[model samples]
Each structure stands twice: as C-alpha cells, then as structure tokens.
Target: MTTSYPAQFLAVAGTRPEVIKLAPVLMAFAERSAEAKAALGVTGQHRNLIDAALNLFGLTPAFDLNLMRPGQSPAEFMGRALVDLTTILQHHQPRPAALIVQGDTTTATAAAWTGFLSRLPVAHVEAGLRTRDRRQPFPEEINRRTIGLLADWHFAPTPRARDHLLAEGVASERVLVVGNTVVDALRWLQQRLTEADLPASARRVLDAGYRLVLVTAHRREAFGTPLRNVLLALRDLVMSFENVRILFPVHPNPAVQEATREHLAGVEQIQCVEPLNYRQFIAAMSRADLIVTDSGGVQEEASSLGVPTLVTRDQTERPEGVEVGLVRLVGTERRRIVAEAAALLGDSTRQTRPDRPLNLYGDGQAGRRIVAALLGDANPPPPFVPSIIPTNSSDECRYESTQDRCGFQWSGPRHSRH
Candidate 1:
C-alpha cells in the first residue's frame, strides 16, 4: 500500500504557544516522514516569539507569510492573514492531505477557515477548548469555537473539550479526546537538556546563584495599559531582589517592544533578550525559579516542570495548573503582580518531589492518541477529564508518566486506492 498526497502534511501555527504545542504533532508527522511529507506554514502572526519556540523545537516553517511585520491592528492583521491564508489554501502544488492546527489564535482560525473553504479536511489538535464567556478571553474563545465549526477531525486535549464540541453540535465520531502533546514536549526537552549538558557560558549564568524567572507576555488584550502594568511590576521585582535575574524573552510585536522597553529599560537585573528557540526556551524554563507569562502554554509547561507560574492575564484556557497549586493568576495588576512575585522569589515547586502526579494533561503520548483515533484504534484509553483546560481555577491535578503514555495507537492503516 502506498500513501499519496504531497507526501507531506502542512501544519499552520502563528504564535509561540501554537508553535510549542504543535511541535509534538509536527514531530509525530516527521516521524513518519519516510512515508509522508510535512511542511509548516507561518502566518507571522507571532513573528519573533514564534521563531524562538520553533528553534527550541528544532522545527522550521516551509512558508513564512509576514502578516504582522508592519504591526497591524486586530482588524487589519486578521483581515490580511485571512486573505493570505485563502491564497495559500488555493495554491500549494500537490496539496497536503491534512492540515494540522493547534489551539485558537488568529492564525489558526484563518488557516482552518481557509482549509474548510478549499474543501480540505482539517485535523485540529487541541480542539474544542472554550472559555464559555467569550468576551472574557475575547477573540480566542471565539476563534477556537469558530474553527471547530468547520474542522473535520477534532483532537481534543480532554473530554471536557470534546464535550464542548458535542454540545455545539459537532458529531461525536469526529471528536477524539487526545491528551495534550505538551507533556511529551516538556519531557523531551527535560531529557535532552539533562543529556547534552549546558554550555559553559549559559551554565556559568545559571551557576552564579542568580535566581532566574522566566517571563513572557504578548496578547492583544494586554497591548497598552495591561502591558505596561505587567512590565512595570516585573521591573520592580528585579530591582527589589538581589541575584534575582528575570529572563524576559521579548515578543516581536512593535507594541510589545515599545511597551517593554518603556517599562523595562534601565532595569539592570532584568535581561530583556531576543526570543530564544523552543529548546533554548525550555532550557530557560528548566533553569527558572518561577515562570511568569500571559501564555496558556507556559501555564501547562510550568505545571509539568513543577514550577510556580504567575499568569499575567485575567483568565486562562489551561487551568489545570491552578487546580494543582502550581500556577497562580496575578493578571496585569502592577502592585498585585509585584507582591505575588516577591513572595515566590525564594520558593518554587520542585519537579523532583515524589508526590506530584502528572494527570491534568496526559502522559506525553497525546500525539500517538490522535493518530490512533484517526485510524480507529481501540485501546484502554484514560478517561479524559471533562473540565476545561484551566488557566487559573484551582481544582484537581492528577499526574501521569511517559511510561503511562498510550495516548495514541493505530488499529490499522487506511490505504486509499489511487
């Protein structure tokens, strides 16, 4: 039996979070490169931040559409990306058999919509995530739900997300509750870092008794005032603590740059450096004392690493960490953020603690589960928690292991007669 199509699949990711989560899926697809071709497309919605995550993951986008270079308003970026995506969907010689997209970002929404209109079936990873309160998370809550309307296969991270789609009238057969692939990513990075050993320069930086805080923030909602508040609080934290270094990876958005510099400049202890690659970012995460960000992915990553995270946003789509006491929400409140951060300066949850269980997401094999479901595999699958991927609500946190990963398995191959 021969597999056909462009011999590769296309994955569309625009932000750092999307790139981070999608890496596992892309790697899974890459694992099958002997039989399939996988190409990545960037909408440039995330630009610099995305590039860092991609480099860390050691993945590359086949096409880069500089959608956000000049810095467009939400309306402008969305409209432009949509038009660009439609063009990509219309062209691309020997089109991919499936398009892989993760989570809800402007880029994912546009790509999915374009794929749908092109009559190209989409396999949406991290599908069916919802906040219920649309305006609270703004376009994200809507972006994901909207993409679900047209997606052919939903690779949900939990039963809750799957149920969300079912409630919205998506067919049960089309929704598969695959655990999140992030744990796999985290585990992979953890192993790689442990094995390779850090370089002298980076290791020296880590060894200097400097407590590192990994910080990231880039959201349309947090553009002006909210951005300033968070940045100021971070700057204050650096000034207040000794040997406390803040590794703030600056996002490429002009607004983010201007706001970060305006608030973070002259703060000697804070290193607002260029975005590091995915592997490099993970190294930073691994080396961090505490993680601070407005990113949903960071919440999940920090949780898996057992690091305490202060989410700068008002709400989050991944609340699993908060449920387990691994993540806290400080929003963009300056004084509140500074106070909370100061408290965590000397303490952090140790990943080596024997008591922590890894369940809120799944064992690292989510990618496997997705492939299995697509091929109609039946295994003793873990029952997915039907709660939303918590960004800040504290609840139940069940941890699992990579050894426990049976996240995906295939019953049989589907061979089409060409």
Candidate 2:
C-alpha cells in the first residue's frame, strides 16, 4: 500500500503575499494521492515577512535560497534569484517535472524564466491580472506579463482574468479560472481565529467603541511623494476626528521606516506598530470599520470579509471589489484619502451589504481545483464561476433557489469548463 511519488512540482515563493496565496495549493497537494508530490522553494525576498507567513501555514521550504540583501532593488533580486534557481533546477536530485510560481513578484518571474531555460513546464498561479499600464505598479504589471509569456499553464483567479490571458493569445486549453487562493487561506485561518486574538491596540479601539481604521501603504510606486501624501492624510484624519483610531502595521523597509518616523512618529491617535502576523492581520480586518491600503492582497481579503476598503493607488489589478461597491480607488493624494476616509467614517449607515453575496474573488475552493488541474486529473474539479452581480444595482441580486448563497441570473455566456 506504499506508493511513492516523484517530485513532480516545485512551488516558489519569495514574498509574504506569495506564501499566503500559495500555502493552500501546497496543502492541497499533500492531501492528494501519492502521485501528486509537490515541493516548496523559498527565495527569502521578504525575509522576516516570508518566514512569518510560512510558519503561520506550517510550511517548510525544501530549498531556501536566502537571497535577500539590505535595500535590494528588483533588478538585483532578479539577477540573484535567476542564478540560484537555475542551479537548483539543474543539479537537484529528483528533478521537478514543472515549476510553480504564484502571483507577480520578482522571484516568480525569475523562477519561471529559469524553469523555461531548464526545459521544464511552468505553472503561473494567480495569473492574468492586469492594470494595463506597465509603470503604474512599477514592475509588477510587467512581471506578470512576462510570466504569462513563459508559463505553460495559467491558473487565473476569475473569468475576467481568463479573458485577459486569452486575448493575449494564450491557448484556451492552457488556462483555468480557479478562484483566488487568498479566500482559501482566509477560510482556513478563520476557524482558528477569535476576537481575543486581535492586537491589544485594535482591541482597545473596538472595546471603547471608537472607529478602527486599518491602514497599510507600502509599495515601490508609493516610495517618495506618494507615501508622504498617504502618511499626511492619515495624520490629518486622526487629528480631525477624535473617535477615529488608525492602526498601522509598518513595513520594515528602510525608506518606509524613515518616512513613517518623519511624518507619523509622534501622532497619538495613529499607532505605528511593527508588522502583524497573518492571523493578527486577519483578525484586525474582520473587526476593522474601514481599511486603507495599497496592497492587492488586502483588497481581496477585505472584500471577502465584507469590509469597506479605500485603495491608495491610481489603478488596481483587482477590480472585482470595486465593481461590487465594497472598495473604492482613492489614489495617493493627501486630500483625496482624507476626504474618502472622512466620508466613510462620518456616515454610520454606509456599509457593505451583508447579503449582497460578493464572492466575486473566490469561494475558498481554489486550492483543490488548482491541485487537480496540475495532476492532470481526468475529471478535474469544475472551474470557479462567479455570480453575476451588477454594479449600482442592488435589485439585481437574486438568491439561488436551491442554495443559501445569493447571485444574479445572467444571460451571458458561462465559462464553467474545466
């Protein structure tokens, strides 16, 4: 009864988001039949953040590249990751059948390219996201596009994402619309989290009945002036409203730390604590009144929790939340951020409708579907089909007659093929 499985897949993760998104897929692989052996490779692009996420998910990387350096640029990281990943693919015993890279990080791009060069198939998870403008997200847009070119299999999160890949000439059979794995990660963590697990500052804000505004804005595009605008806006919001408390989990980048100290160090209402673990962050999101962030993952997580979010970017690759009125793009202007946050905070009636059924991003089964597809299952799990909910039309939502979930009846073509 002991069946051995070869190392058929090598999953690479380098950032916190990558680890969080990929954890469920890795876990699913373990749950599959013995032939579905998959291994993890860590690049240490986000060092402490990556380790925290891996520990939270109880995952250990088979190969730890440890390629991070102080204030390393994307180009530098790419060069180093490319060299090391190439060596691993070429020399490691039990050579993997394919390379798995999740999301659009420098590590993912480098690893995918290396896999292609080493004559291995590449699978791109969370693929086909696009902001159209390559420079807006500063390399992420470009990075994902490049991965799209090199990847043999594209695991898109939504139908829209699948369309993006198809329009770009990706073969129809090569793409599958698996819902985002973030929802899977959230579902797994929600069972283990409680209100008691929230950070002390967050708990105080909620217990005292003060509005808690969770803020996270650390992106390459928002380094200098844009970051300053966000910090100044937060400072202004807390100063203007006595009952509003800002809980910011600061990133450890030197530039971000320096700017945060310069602008928000002494602010009493704004608590600039160290970065939170994944569990703490999810707990905070569940209880937060409002969230302002420049992170794509936060957008997906907040939407799933039905939390209102203000994205501090001009463009977002994740537009599913925006379409459902759960999120708004406020850009990185000081006045705009303050104005939007003030409006949401001032109006107690403004809330994401609990019954709106905004599962546009996912329904927490993405991991199983992805694993089945990678293993070439003869009967793969059905691709995720999002309920069609129209923007600005609450009356359009209809409950499924047989199920407890809500969705609108759509007359358009469906893409439920596996």
Candidate 3:
C-alpha cells in the first residue's frame, strides 16, 4: 500500500452521471485535505449537460481536457480523449498515484486505458456492471468489461457487482462492495431540494395536483425504433389518463430531439421540453409518482426515492430494483410499455408509496468508503490464497508471463487465478 506518487488522486468525469456519482467522493477527498488531494479531469464529452451537476456539488476540474466535438463518432471521440488524457497525465505535476473513472462513458474507458498505459493504477467506480449481451447497451457493456480487465482497484457499488468482478477473474481482494454512489447523490439532492426551488414546469405540474410521471430515454441501443415506440407509449399514457402528467427532459442529441418532436409533439398532458438542470431534474424525480426511463442512473435514483419505475429497456444492469419490484423492465414494445405505465398509474393511485422503501443501492455512505480506499486509510483484504498447480516447479514459472506460466496467471499485484 506504499507508492512513490504524492497523496493525491486523479478523477476523470465526462457525462452528467459521472459528475453526479463522483461528486460526493470528490467532496469527501476535499474534506480530508490533510490526507489527500483530488485532481479532477473533465473530458468535456458531455459539455453543457455536465456543468449543472458539477456546479450543484461545487466541483471544478483541475485538468479540463475540453476534448468534445459535435458529430464525432465514438471511435473518433475516444481516440481524441485518449490522446488528450495522455498529454494531461504526462504534464501533470506531482503525478497522481491512481486514476478514478466512474461508470462506462467513453471518457471513463479511454481514461482508464490511458492511465493503465501510463503505469498508473486505475480505480473504476461503479465497476463490474454487465448486461451479458454486449449489444443491449452497445459500447457501455464492452466498456465496463474492459475497465474491469484493466482496473487495479474495482470499487463495485453492490455485492452483486463485486461477485461479477470476482467471477470474471478480478481478485476478490481488489473489489469492494461500497454500494452505488448514485444513491449518495440522490440523498444529497433530496436533502437540499424543495418545491419552491423547482422549475416552473415541474412546479406547475405539482401545483395542479397531477400525478407526475418523469420520463427520460437516450441510450445508444434505444435509438431509432425503440425510441419511437417508447414515445408512442407515452403518448398513449397521457391520452388514456386525464390526471397523468408526463415530463420528458429531452436530450439534445438530434436523434432524440427529432423523435420526441415527431412522436410526442402536441400530445396532451405531456411536456417534452429541453433537458433540465441537475436540481430541476432531481425535483422532477422527487415529485414524480411513477418514473419511466431507460437511464441507468434514473433507475438507481428513482428507486432510492421509493418511487416505482418502469425501465424502458430489455435488460438492466441495476437489477436490484427489478428484483425488489421497484423497477420493471418494459422493453420498447409500445404495448408492453403502455400497459406497464397504465398499470403503474392505477397502482400509484391505490398506494401512495411502494410496499416499502428498498435501500438496495446504498445507505448514503458510499462516498466515505470510496475515499477511505483511495487514501489507503481502509484495511486491505487478507492476502489472496492461490490454489493452482504450477506448470513447472521453478521461480521462473511463478514470475513468468501468463502465456509462459501455468494455467493460473497473476492478474494484478494481488490477483492470481486458475
């Protein structure tokens, strides 16, 4: 647990979720200034969407790569991020001992790879999430797996996530079940939010006494027909229920905007407007009677608030919600989506809250656990007990590369598996 680098850690964030989830951990690091310093790196992949989240938590990046470009393909964007991140790490004074990236954005994946190539240990927050079928959440599924492969420290947000990493050959000792930081963020926002501070749209909905249903859908796999169908289903819900009010904070992406405009435009009891700021978005989630979205963060946030949610995806990595009956996966099929929403609407009328609040994600202390690990203040797991037969009974066999050694291979400083 000793290193040459200073008592400082590097944090990289790009998307809004990354900003939101990492903010609490960064705040914790800042509080322990005598212990460690946090150096933030913003890839600017999400630009405007990231600002509100950062501002809400009072975070300003020390290293702003400013690498976003409109209309760039994922490969193009990732390539540029990798290059810029390399340059940033190269010139960073008192180089960071570990690089921290949250979730599975291109910025996270690229930064993790860059840190690995630079010989810096990487800590992946919200690690070990998987949908099994990579294509379901294109790029993200593969990205999370890649980070798990390269990360020296995996801060899994759940016991299930930690188990996934262990099953994938990540040393059990390297993974910690710290709970999801999204819950931490939700708890933070909920404490500070009120109806008076809500945006005019959200306040109006609440003032009018309509049962709010917050909707958000902008996943790579959910584009085109899936997006269209979800919108259509929302249209059906608004028309079918007079008291149901739907608030969709449409993403700025052209595909998302065009679809929302095309399918949901002029729909009664539905407000499809531009995206809201972090507080406003939280206000919407806080006041919503039922949540409908394909967002990973929303699933965690809504469930954390005890709101019943309908996930508009075929599968979700955050299955704890689904398992607890707080979230249901109603894929993009219009009939299923409409039916689930309608049923939920009826169910919401019958019950004011879920059967009970499920603290499936976190108890609002994941930030402290993450900070303890980053500062090396937490006790390390006991030494791994390797159970493998060597191919050759020699020191070279133990020290050699995986290809040259036995079936068991050393994965990290503390990782070895059969």
Candidate 4:
C-alpha cells in the first residue's frame, strides 16, 4: 500500500471548539485544488467530543495523535504532543506548506511552538482574542499570547481582536480581521437542523409549556466553588418558578462531573445528561428560551441564534455579544445568576429577539476570506468591518507606548493599512 499526502496546509484541532472553528477553513480549502487543499491533524485533546464534532462536519483527519487521557494535566499533554507533532512534520511525505491552528488551547500552543521549532510558517485562526488577565481563564490566556508571538499570520475574528494584536505590537500586515468562522459553522449546521432533531429532554420542556434554560459550564476556572454556586442557583430558579425547567449537558471532566452529580443529580425539573453532539446541541440552542454558559463558542452560537444568554464568567474574550444587549455577564455568583435568569424568564419579550442586528460576530463568509488570505490571491476578501463599535466598556488597545504591560515590544506601525 502507498500513502499519498494531499495536504498543503496541515490544519490541527484538539478539542470540539477547535474542530468547529477549523471545519470552515478546511471546507474552504477543499473547494480549491493543487496547493490549496488542507489535511486535518487531530491531537485528541478531547477524544470523544472531538470525534463528534469531526463527524458533524463530515471531516476525517489525515493523522491522529490520540493524546488524550483521563486525569491528564496540561503540561503532560503538551510534552507528549510536541514530540508527536515534531515526528509528523519531519517524516510526512511532501511536508505541509503551513501549519494551521485555532483558538487558545494547549494543543494549539504546542502545535504553534512545534511549527516554529520546525521552521514552518504557522497561521493562527480565530486569533487576537484577549481577556487581558492570564489567571482568569488560566493557561488559555497565556497559550494564545504565546501563539501570537510565534505565528506568522493571525486570522483575527473581529476588529476588536485585530486591535488587541496591534496593541501587543504584532505586525498589522500579519493580522487580518476575518470574521469568526464559528458563524460559518453555525450557519451551515442550522440549515440542516430542525426542531425534531433536538434531544428528547429538550423537547419535553417545550411541549410542557415550561420555559427552558439551557446550561453549560465546564471551564477550569469554574471547577469548584463557582460551579457549585451555579448549580445551587439553578436549583433555586427551578424551585422558585413553576414554569421553569433546566437542561444541563454535563461535561465529561471529572471535576465538573463530580460537582454536577453531587449538586444536580436526580433533582426535579433539572435534566442532567451526557454531552450532546454538535447537531443536537445546535437544535437545543435554537429552541432554548435562555442560555447560561461559560463556554466561549456557546456565547457566539447563542448570540447568532438570538437566544438571550447569561455568561457565568467575570470576563470574556468574545465581548461583541455583550456590546449588544443579547448577552450579559452574570459571573458565577449564585444571586447574580438567579437574578439575571429570573429577569429574562419573567419577561417573555427578552427570550428571543430575532430582529436584533446580531451579525456583530460574522456574516458566514469568514471561511472564504481565510482561504483567500492563505492562498495569497491577488484579490483577497475585504476585511470584516463590524457595524457596532463598543462604547460602554474600554475594549480598545490601552497600551500607552510601543511596549505593552506584558513587556512585548511592537516594532511595526500601530495602525493597519487595510
């Protein structure tokens, strides 16, 4: 048997969110021939979850590292992935022209670093997102910052994200404000999904004339005390309102699973089940009256669907949704969560406002723009210009000099020509 390498771009994904965001870019590459096609490399940071997302997009990886293990630490995973990725880059026939990675994960950071060590040009997708506080999101903030320093091209998802890179002194020419590919993925999934595709647990709530509050909380920051507060708040909400029901798709993480089982297992009006596949999750989100989550991807998905959302975090990298009134940051405080959820549930008008201008994240053509940029076409797609600029909060680049607070010095011009 002979193995043929058809990949010009070696796109890598380790988690479900990475798979979702990268799927659009891979699809875009598929439309082209000869030097434009990409081959996927799965790091298996999230095993089953990554498989479900890959299946949803009809994608198969050219290489699978299968690195995930129960009770694995980020440091351990990074060490293993770095060695495996290096072997792939060195021995693969017709080495990939560029190494592509998405979002802020240990896998992405490791891959970007490996690419740099291998002297390969690295292109970062969904780049330039920052919460500014490294400890808040733990490791992810630092992982993305490291990638920013190493990547040759930064495919920023919004004007805000591009500005963050510029503030950090990254070359403006290297950063392109391509809209978020999550919107592209969401739009593609929504076209094929229907009400019947929703999980049975979700459908029962809607049929019973009860307002459904879909919940998802799995961030490392929300592991112990914060997660318990959120679960307690959900119990309070259900006990307080007769027409309210909760549907939480529990993450497979041991910390999250333990907390969920201890606080929410066998609780009345709350359906705690295993994680739903991408398609069923999309169907569930569409019919959800309100969403409470700490996942960044869910924030974008809920906002795009016009489903009112309450973010259970102190800060978010994706603040475009908050710039509009569609999303609110309630943090992990029990009282705050209950108050916000109650306020939205009590008012029927706040549930789903489909008429709101919710294209702040994207217009679903981000995949095409990314492909044009990667191919170095003569005419690249125009940059995604957001209609709504943030005013309520200070989202601009706050660095006073060429050197930022983090000690990264910018050598290029501050303003972008594009």
Candidate 5:
C-alpha cells in the first residue's frame, strides 16, 4: 500500500507542536501535487493558531474535527476526538494509504488509534521521544508510548529515542531514526516567507533592529505562582534591554492571558504579538537573539537554528539541545531566566554570533525516509514499546495484522462535522 501511493500521506495534527513538526512532511506530499494529496484532518485540539500556520504552508485541512470544548480534560478531549475523527475517517474519499502524525497529543493519539483500527498504516514522526520520567510531561509521555505500540512505522528523531524503543522491545525493523522534521518545517517556513506575508503590526515591530526575545510559556506546572515569576522576569528584561523587543505569542488559555497581562501589560519595549503564523514564526525565531519558552518544540527549534533558548520549565523531553549547549533549562527561575536571556543577548551582536548549528535532529529529510521505510524497502529503527498485552494474540485485533484498518463498519454517522 505504501508503494502503491508513494506520495499520498494523511498528516494529522491538531496541536501547535504537531502542526509545526508535521508541516514539512505535509508539504512533501503537497509538493508532489499530481502524484498525491496530503489531506489534513484537524481534531481541533489546538485549532487556535493552526489555521494561520497552515495558511503559511499554503495548505488547508480536508477535514476539521472541531473537537474542543471551552474546558475539556485529557480524558474528555481524547474520547471526543476519537469518536469524532472516526466518522471523518469513514467519510474521507480516497482514504490515505498512510496516516502520519508527529509527537504526542490527544489528537495524534486518537487519530493514530482510529487509523490503526481502520487498518491504515500510521507513521509516527519524531517517534519515541521520551523523558524517561513519564510524569514530567503529563499525558504526552504516555501518548507517545501508546502510539509507539499502535504505529506500524516509528520514525524516531534520534538514535537515543530509537535505542529507548529497542531496549523496551519494539521490533528493530519497524523503527527508523529519521531525525526531527521541525527543522525541515523551519527551513520551509524560511523559504516560504515574504515581507508582505507578515502581519502589519509584527512587521513594524520587526523592522526597528530590536533584539527579538520570544517568550512562550504554557506548561501545566507553571500555572499559578510559577507563571507570575516568569512574567516578572519578562517585565524586568523589557525594562532593562532598551532595544530588546519581546514578542510573546501568549497561549490561548485564558488563565495564561490574564497572568501574563498582570505583569507584562503597558510596557513599551514589550511588543506582545498574537500567536504568529508558522512561516512568520520560523522567520521570527530564526531572527531571534534569544528565546525564553517552555515548549518542547521551541527547544528543538532553537537547537536547529542554533538560537540559545532559556527554558522556563523545570524540565524538558528534548534536552538533547541543552546537553549539546544550544539550550539552557532556566526552569521558571525568574532571575535565571532574565540573566540567561540577558547574557545571550550581551554576547550575540550583529557580527560575532556564537554558532551551535548542529542538525541534532537530521539533515532535513525525515519525510522522505518515512515514506521510503513505509514502502517496505529496508528496516527502520525501534522505539519504546511498553509491555502491554502480548501482541502475539492476533485473535483480538486482525486489523493490526492486515493493511485495511480504516474501513470500519459504521452503518450510521453519529459524530459531528466541522
């Protein structure tokens, strides 16, 4: 089936990270225009800014599973997403030969499971990224592990991730260390950018030779007091660095907005921009002198561009960047966050930029490797697979054994459409 539709791919993403990392892979399919259709299905988990990102890539979702409620729990979100995406899966004409997803989100988790049930081969991009300590990343750690088990092809981003999978027992032949696709997306965004594409407010802010210090903090741990501390640090930085322009793409969550506004409002140097489009975002990050973010994707992005990152969280899954000197885990430590950003800013002038440009992920070719491996040409790598009910029981789920997992018998359409 992979060979039969070499260019066809159904790249599913709903969260910002999934959308960002999967953008390049999705673009790969779209670039093949005549040979493929890279259909996008948004489970509406993080639809807040994804459309702008998709527009940046010049792509739109074929199906939008607007499966988000104002206040939804992980349990509620995943359950709703699964139920909704199932119907879309049933209706998608010329259903994809492969369903691709990146990282771990309820959308990815639910979609991968639905695809697995529908008997479509699921390829997990950036597969097997683990913090070892599952509790640190909330549901994501579990989601990736679950997807690792459900995914027919695991496209791991690093040897470390691949090794983690092998140590726990995934078949070596099914895993492929295809590096991270975030850089490919970043590169794509860079290539696709035009000054005209930028929002007027963002472009005006960018033109003034202001050292851009991007601040994005939205981790579960940093909700109450921790959020205030990070905000305080930003407040101090903006006042201290006169030419420093802070473009905070605040999280859509209301609490985040209120908390950030409490400390960061009415500051002249601080230009709090809306969550940028993906292409403009890449352009912004590439030009940024220093980044203060708690996002796992930003860690990888900062690493890829060699932009020094000050992580506002206490921990991260992609510490490969920190280990390699591209990022510093400042961990919401107010003074440290301020100081690190200050230090990086002090060192990086227009001329002598401290370069840490290493492709820790890969050579920006993960999608091709993913498609190549899915076609059954060569063995891929391995990722962490938990000791669940033995897979030897083919009696329970024949879909796992067959190529057609997507054609489930849904006599009536119950799930809603977007």
Candidate 6:
C-alpha cells in the first residue's frame, strides 16, 4: 500500500474552523522542505463550507473522504468518518508518522481516536478547551477532553489551556503553550485583503452610513427557542436604533435558515444573507462596529482584531478575550442581549484600545512552533508569551533530557524567553 512519497505527517480537517486553523501548519510544512514531509486529509464533514477556505489558502488534501450524508446524525457521520478514514489510512503507504487534528469537531475526534487505535501518534492543536458541562456545547466539550486524553502532544493556545491539561495529569513534557492557530490565520488573511476584495453585497452595507453590527449564531445549543430569542433581540436592536444596521450570514442548516428567515427576513437595515466565505466574513468583521457570535474561532479573531464582541452562550471555552474586555458573554436571553448590545453601542469611550496589549492569545507563530515541536527541532520560544506566570500544579510539568532541543525545557516553573 506504499505511495510515491510517505506522508511524514497527516493533517486532518473537516470543517471551516479546522481548515482555517490548520492552513498555517500546512504552510509551515510547505515552507520548510528540509523538515518532515506532510499532507492533508479532508473528511468533508462540511463539504460545501470547507472548499472555499481551502481554496483561499491554496490547500488540497491527499484524501477527501466524502463522509457527509444529507441530514446525517452525529453518530452516523462519526461512524462513517471512522470507517472511511481507516480505509484511507490503510491504503496510504508507509502510514503517516503522526496525525494532527484541530478544535473539537466530530471529525477531529474521530480522527484522533482512529490514530490512537491505529497506534499512531496524535497531535491536537487548540487543545485543552473545556466548559466542564458537556451538555452546554453538546459533544464538543467531550470531544476535546477525549482527544486531550488520547493525544501524544497537546499544543495549548494559552497557559490557562496548558494548566487544564497539567491538572488532568497529562505529561508536562508532552504539553506546551503554542498559542492559537486562528490568530495566525486571521493575521494572514488581514495582510492580503483590501476593500476591493470585499463581496459586493458586503461593500454596499459598508458604503451605507449606518454603524455596522455583525451577527452570527449557529451553535447546536442555541437552536430552537434560544435561536428565536436571539433573533428577537436582533429585531429589538434593529427597531431601537435608527442609525445602526446588522449583517447576519445565515447558517445553511434548514432549522437555522427557516427560523432566521421567519424571524428577521426583510427586517429594516438587517441584511440576512447566505453564509460568507472566510475572506468575505473577514471583510464584514472589519467593517463591523460590534460582533455577536457563539463561535469559538470568531472570539479569537475578533479579539485579535480588537473588535468589541458579545457571545450569545451562557458559557464559553474561550474566555481569554473576555478577561481582556474584548468580549462579553451575554447568553441567549433576549433582554440581556438587547441591553448589552445597546449599552456597548451607545458608549463611544469604550471603543478605545486596552491600556496594555492583550498577549493573552499569541503573536501568530503557533504554526511554526507546532511544526518545530513535531520535528523535535528546539528553535525558540513561541513568538509571544503571555505575562501570566505558569502555575505549579500537583502534577507540575517536567521535561525529559533526551527529548530536549536547543536546551529548551518547559518542565520548570520559571519562564525563559528565547
């Protein structure tokens, strides 16, 4: 079952967030030909949404297991992914030395389990996320936890995330704070984008004098009545403010699309359109005065761009942004959502940047550091380390001397900047 070239490492991504975050990792592989060989495997869990981001980043997977079926249940889809992914790997000659997955998608979870069962090392990017209450996010919270236990390397986006892994007794040598890849992807997209590249519909909204408010809500927990309540808040906000306009890119799911159209279609100053591609979404975020979302990746992107954000969930796994005042968790209650949106909208003084830089996330070199770790090349510390001191846990981090490179060891509590 050998191929022309053995894929030294395989990156698995099925949804938009996974693809966006993994893009920089693939780029790291492409840039450093002298390092280990790498390839991508797409599960196509989000077939329609995955390609646009992949095309934007010039990425193509070696295997595309078109595993999604119409109206497929999570169990069905994951079972299919497991079977198809296993088949693909079986046929892949010289099998990948390691399998890398991102976030807490079903695809990532399935791939991690497959890798671990196959006796292959699994590296989890954006690892150690937790809401503790598994039902709040419906499977995502559990997915990351399962992967955290199964993974060989845990690339945490922040020290908080790193501490969670250490508290759970994962090997300190295997865990390292490598920042988040979403920041890397956002920075990369922001660099090449100009106004001319924005979608025509988005451009029209921007050209209008109304202050823009971006809204995106598609979490499973927020469906049904919670979703209706969120739309109700949007309606109230639209009716309350004459000068403000909202742009919401409706999710393609029938339940979501039906409810969105039913509640807010043809509403004044609110453009409820189909979902935007990553670039167009970025453009929309750029033009926005405020952002309301329940997405984990959006929290990271909005915080990195310094946009005021409101999370529509009761709890969030990504709270670094909230700590820095870049985000507020307002839940799905109508009055609370409307009140918070109104308060932030009226306050011009709150628009000023934070007094200090929020390095709570990372500086944008996570992809490189992840690669460096994967290849065991002790380079330097990640581009930016947060000011927070590492906590000494009962299971404090300790590094193996044999695995140390460039004299780098994270086992010690003392921070050393390379």
Q: Which candidate has the highest lDDT of all?
A: 2
lDDT of 3 by residue, 1-418 (tens): 1223333799999989999999888877878888788867799898869887778888877767777787788999999999888887887768887999999989999999999999999999999888899887888999999998889999887766776787788887788878788877887887898866677887788899998999898898988998999999898888888998988899988889898889977886888878998888887787788899989998888876677789999998887667545689989999998898888778523434433333567767788788887778757433212121222222221211134222224333431111
How far residue 53's Cα lies from its native spot in candidate 6, in Å, is: 0.8
Candidate 6: which pairs clash? none
Residue 135 lDDT, candidate 4, scale 0-100: 80
Ranking the candidates on TM-score from highest down gives: 2, 4, 6, 3, 5, 1
Minimal lDDT window, size 10, model 4: 393-402
Model 2: residues >4 Å from true position, as ranges? 1-6, 352-357, 388-418
Task: Go through the candidates in order and give the clash count of each.
Answer: 25, 0, 0, 0, 12, 0
After superposition, which runs of candidate 5 have C-alpha atoms over 4 Å from their true positions?
A: 1-9, 30-38, 91-96, 196-209, 348-351, 354-357, 378-418
Per-residue lDDT of model 5, residues 19-65, tens digit only: 77777777666555665567676877876877776676666776677
For candidate 5, the lDDT comes to 0.71
Clash pairs for candidate 3: none
- For every candidate in turn, the CA RMSD to the true structure comes to 8.9, 5.7, 11.3, 6.4, 13.3, 7.1
Candidates in order have lDDT scores of 0.72, 0.86, 0.79, 0.85, 0.71, 0.82
- Candidate 5 C-alpha RMSD relative to the actual structure: 13.3
Between 2 and 3, whose lDDT is larger?
2
Ranked candidates, highest lDDT first: 2, 4, 6, 3, 1, 5
Q: Write down the TM-score of every candidate.
A: 0.80, 0.91, 0.87, 0.91, 0.81, 0.90
Lowest-sum lDDT 10-residue window in model 2: 398-407
Superposed by TM-score, candidate 4 places the C-alpha of residue 37 at a distance from the truth, in angstroms, of 1.3
